[model samples]
Target: MDTILWIIAAIFVIAGVVTIVRGGLIYGIVLIVVGLLIGPGGVSVFS
Candidate 1:
């Protein structure tokens, strides 16, 4: 489960970067923020 979450987080980060380069600034920022919040070292407030 942990590994899966990390992988998802990585995908989100990459997607965010691509979105930003493609001019989807708001979506990109949202994805990146979500990624950070759920990433490996992120704050586990919900967890």
Candidate 2:
């Protein structure tokens, strides 16, 4: 389950990068932030 979340976070980060490159700055930023907050390190906050 943890590994799955990590993988999802990676995908979100990657998608965020693509969004930024495609001129969706706001969306990209949101995606990246959400990705970070969902990643392992960020779990401490919720935990």
Candidate 3:
């Protein structure tokens, strides 16, 4: 479960970066925040 969350978080963060590069600054920041919140290393939503 932790591993899965890590992978999902990573994907979200990467997508966020790509989105930012694509000019969606607000959306990108949202995605990165969500990713961090969902990750076990941070404050996991599942918890």
In TM-score terms, which candidate is top? 3
Query: In candidate 2, what are the lDDT values of residues 1-47, reduced to their tens digit?
Result: 67877888888889999999999999999998888888886752344
Which rank order by lDDT, best down to worst? Answer: 3, 1, 2
Q: Which regions of candidate 1 are displaced past 4 Å?
A: none
lDDT of each: 0.85, 0.84, 0.97
lDDT of 1: 0.85
Please tell me which model should have the higher TM-score, number 2 or number 3: 3
The TM-scores of all predictions, comma-separated, are 0.84, 0.84, 0.96
Query: How many Å off is the CA of 46 in candidate 3?
Result: 0.6
Minimal lDDT window, size 10, model 1: 37-46
How many clashing pairs in candidate 1? Answer: 0
Better-scoring candidate (lDDT), 1 or 3: 3
List the pairs of residues colliding in candidate 3: none
Model 2 spans with C-alpha error above 4 angstroms: 44-46
Q: Is candidate 1 or candidate 3 better by TM-score?
A: 3
